[model samples]
Every structure is written in C-alpha cells, then in structure tokens.
Target: MAKILVVEDNEDINEILKNLLLGEHQVIQAYSGTEATLLFKQEIFDLVLLDIMLPGKDGGQVLQEIRQSSQVPVLMITAIGDKQSVTQYLLNGANDYITKPFDGDEVKARIQVQLRQTMSQELAGSKRQEYGHIELDSQTFTVSGPLGQVSLRKKEYDIFQLLLDHPKQIFTKEKLYEQIWQDVYLPGDNTLNAHLSNLRKKLKEVDDCHEYIETIWGLGIRLKEWQSS
Candidate 1:
C-alpha cells in the first residue's frame, strides 16, 4: 500500500479523503501547509494530496520547496482552478490538479496513475545505466569500461547522469544549465561547455573507441546509440 500525505484545511473534506483512501493506502493527515511540510520532511511519502489554498505556506510554495529535494508525486487540490492557476501549478512541478468537491473515483484513479509512474522511475533509477560497453554506476558515481574505472566529480557526474538517465532525449544548453546548476542560462556563459569538455575527456580516458555524448550543432546534446555487431 502507498503512503500518502493528505493536506487539506477543512476538517470534513480531510476526513472524507482519509476515509476514501484508508482501505487502499496509508493516509497521513495535515491541516495546514506548515504542518504538511513538516510531516513531509519527517517522513517519506509515496504521494501527496495537496490543497492549493492553505494556511502558512500555499500549495504552490510548498510544491516549489518539495521539488528542490524530492520528486514525490503531487496531486494539487484546488477550490478555484482557473486556467492560469492550473498552468502555474504544472509549470511549478505538480503532477496533476484536482478541483475541490472531488469525485472519489477520480481521485483514486489519479493517485494510482501517479503511484505507478513514480514506481517505474524508482525501479529504473535503482539499476545502473549501460551504453555500449560502458556501465555508469550512479550509486557509486563511477563509470567503468574494459580499460578501467574512473571516478567522476560531482558536476561531471551530474551532467553525465542527466544524459544517461534520458538516453536519446536531447537537452539544450539552457535546460542543462537550469537543471544542473539551478541558475538562469546566459548566452555568454561558457560554464556548460567547459563541463561538457571535462566530462568528455573523462569518458574518453575510460574508453576511447565510443563517442557517447552527441552535439547536435545549434540544438543540444543527446546520448548516441552504440552500434551492434
């Protein structure tokens, strides 16, 4: 059963949610945003049912804070969901939005979807990434090949991990900068280029034959597929 945090200010609605999910999952309750955040920090929950309007910290603020640390699935609970509010919530990292006076079946179905997706990602993350003859042990922060194993510095590993995790997904310089460095991308910043150069050098040292990171000219970078015999 999944562990879920239900954050709603109204006692009646909170109890309704708890009762609906009680038999299927473990429900942890919080009546305010501050209380919810505190509970979230203290325990690891599989999913969060968060109300958009709350006392202390709003759901959007709570979600932003949560994104900084964990990628736990969040279903935003809203009483008044305008288009702008929904867009803003999604852009800020909420998995889905549920308007208030919810349907029990709909909430359950959405929760199940998020739970399944999160489980898939967690399972994938537990396995080491392999491309061609190279194995990247994200757990150990090491890349190994027939030549030898090389330890990656934090930034090098972060950059490599991003591409390795997504495989063929091309990431633009700006996206890489924002995701990795958590900073705005400036046109003149050579920081990403420098890191890519260092990362490539390290990879080449381990295995010279394969070119792993592909530069798509003015577009971005992606992991190249290794040819089979």
Candidate 2:
C-alpha cells in the first residue's frame, strides 16, 4: 500500500477521503498549502491530493513549490466546470485533475491511475540496490527511507543505484557517465553533478543517519560502508 497525503481543507471531504483510503494505505492530511509544503519536506508521500481553492498559498502555488524541489505526483481537485482552473493547474505542473462535486468512485479511480503511472515509471528505471540507509526496489523503482518509501525520477535514482550496485568499487566520472546518461556526448560536466546533488539531498532527507555516497577526491564516487570510513 502507498502513503498518501490529503491536502484538502474541507472537513467533510477530508473525512470522506480518510474513510476511502483507510483500509488500503496510510493517509495524512494537510489543510493548507503551507502545511502541505512543510509536511512534504519533513516526510515522504506517494501522492498529494491538492484542492485548488486552498487557503494560505492556493493549489497552483503549492504545486509550483513542490515541483521546484520534488517529483511527487500531484492530483488537483477543482470545482464543477472549472476547465480553466484545470488547464491552469496542469500548466502549473499537476499530474492529473478531478473536479468538484466528484463521485467517490471517480476519485478513487483517478488516484489509482496516477499511482499506477508513478509506479510503472519507477519500475522501468531503477534496478535492485541498497544505498546507505536506503533500499531501492527495482521492480517498482521506488526508494525506501526511514520514515517510509517514495518514488524518484529516473536520472536521480539511476546515479545512486549505480554506486550502490557496486559498493566500495571506485567508479570514475567517466564510468558513471557511461552508465547513467548512456553517453558523454551531451549536457557535459555540469549535468552529472546536478543529478548527483539531487540524489544526495534526497537520500539525506530519507535517512539522515549516514552519508551513503562519498566523493573520491579527483576521481569519482563510491557507495560508502555503513559502519565506518
């Protein structure tokens, strides 16, 4: 079962979502955009059900902020006939949209679709590996941390996966370059660092107990040992 974060402000609707999700997965609620962003950084969630008319920061703004730092799937909840709102939110980066006055079954179906897509994409990317205090599920392409598990973008996890796949093996930048991006003919040096930075930051978020990735002076990187240097 996946962990879902419900970001709706309405008490009745929140209760309905709670009941709808209770048996299958863990669900947490955040009533405002501010709360959602804070919880998002503090913990991992599989999907975010965001209401467009939320107080404090609104759905679009919250979605923007999340996309800036995370790739978690977001499904926007809008009002009836709110085509403009849906369009605007999508342009703003929502994974999917469900209108207001929604049927219970429809809500569940849409959520399932997004979750399924998220899972599918993950499975296609990562291969089984253990990095630091984290576990990577290659079949599902998800990463599990101390708090819970969450999905990651391909490039981000691929970099970490490579190091973990061969723990303590020194992989030069060229080797890592060949493995992850498949070629060194494109974005250049800055590109690799950008992805590595993202992986390191996210892994730290998952488990702050240790640093799993270690840079090897002027050569490359290696997955560090769990107990000691």
Candidate 3:
C-alpha cells in the first residue's frame, strides 16, 4: 500500500476520495491550501490528489509551492477543467490530472499506475548500480528486493534511473525538473520533496539503513558511495 495526500477544500470530495482509496492505500486529507502545504512539509506521500479551487492560497499557488521542492507525482483535481486549465497545471508541473465527477475505478487505476511506477523505479536500482538485496536489472525492467519485485512507471523510471546512473553527484531540483520534467520555474515547489519521500520509502522497504539516498541540506539529494553497490 502507498500513502496519498488529498488537498481539497470541499469536504464531500475529500470524503469521496478517502473512501475510494482507503481500501488500497493510506489517505491524508487537507482542507485548504495552507493545510495541504503544511502536511507536505511534514510527511512523505506517494501521490497528491490536489484541487485547484481552494481557500487562502488557492490551487495554483499550492501547486506552485509543491513543485518548488518536491518531485512526487501530483494529479490535479478540478470541477471546471478545460484545455487551458490542463495546459496551465501541466506547464506548472503536474504529472496527471482529472476533472470532477470522475469514476472511482479510474482513480484507482491512476493510483495503481503511479504506485506501480514507483515500484518499478525501486527495483531498477540505479544505473551501473548492482546493489545487494535491491537489484535493478534495467535490461529486464525488473526491481527485486530481498522480499519481491515490481515494475516502474515511465516518469519514475526516467528520473530514478538518472539518479542511479550518477549516485555520487547532486542533481539540483532545477536540473532534475529540466532533465526529467523538461522545464523550470522560480522559487520552486515541494515536487522534489514529494518524489524524495517516495524514493526514501522504497529504499527503506528493501534496505532499512537507506544510505543510498542522502540529503545535502539546501543543495539536493544523492546516494552515498558506501550505500551503493
């Protein structure tokens, strides 16, 4: 099971998503933009179900904040979605999106897709990294920990594979966004934090020490030499 953060002002939608997703994953809800950003700074989540029309900071602002520091997958939730709105959020840095009155099965499918992608990235390990316990055989596209194995989503595999390819070097969020997401914006958001949380969690499941991912404080995150195989 994975952890999800739901950022929406409407109580009804929050409850709906909670009920729909609670069966397969843990759900955390935030009523407003402020609350959502707070939870993001404090915990790790696999995906974020974010709404655009929110109190205080609003959805756009909240998304902006998240993108600055996180790389966690974000799926924008909306009531009034259009081509322009979709383009705006995508350009701002959202992985996927859905309009309101959506199907529960569709949400589940999307969530599963993201989770599976994450699982894949974990197994792939790092580039040139044939580590113990956690083995990522890129050729076969399989990630096997001591316990089991899984496949990675396209985006997750791309960014994670890049890090594994260069375990020692620190790739700034801007660089990562450009390299992975293909763009950059000012001040940044928690997008990097979101992705890091997922990355760290995967590492822990296979290797509790999780030394492969190290935070350099203000600089960025990278894998430790001793931790890498």
Best by lDDT: 1
lDDT of 1 by residue, 1-229 (tens): 9999999999999999999999899999999999998998788788999998899998988898889767899999998848897888998899998887889999999999999998778767865878888888866678998789998876788998888789889899999989987779999999899989988988998888888899999999988877754
Steric clash pairs (candidate 1): none
Q: What tens digits encode model 3's per-residue C-alpha lDDT throughout 1-229? A: 8899999888998999999988788999999999999998788788999998899888889888888667788999988747897888989988888888899999889878877887787667644346645776565555567656655544555666777889778977788767776667346587766766776566566666446667788997666666344
For lDDT, candidate 1 versus 3, the one ahead is 1
TM-score each candidate. Answer: 0.58, 0.61, 0.57
In model 1, the runs with Cα more than 4 Å from the true position are: 128-229
Tens-place lDDT per residue, model 2, 55-120, is 898888899888866678899988848577678778878898877787889988888888999888
Q: Which residue runs does candidate 2 get wrong by more than 4 Å? A: 128-229
Model 1 poorest 10 in a row by lDDT: 118-127
The lDDT-based order of candidates, best leading, equals: 1, 2, 3
The lDDT, on a scale of 0 to 1, for candidate 2 is 0.81
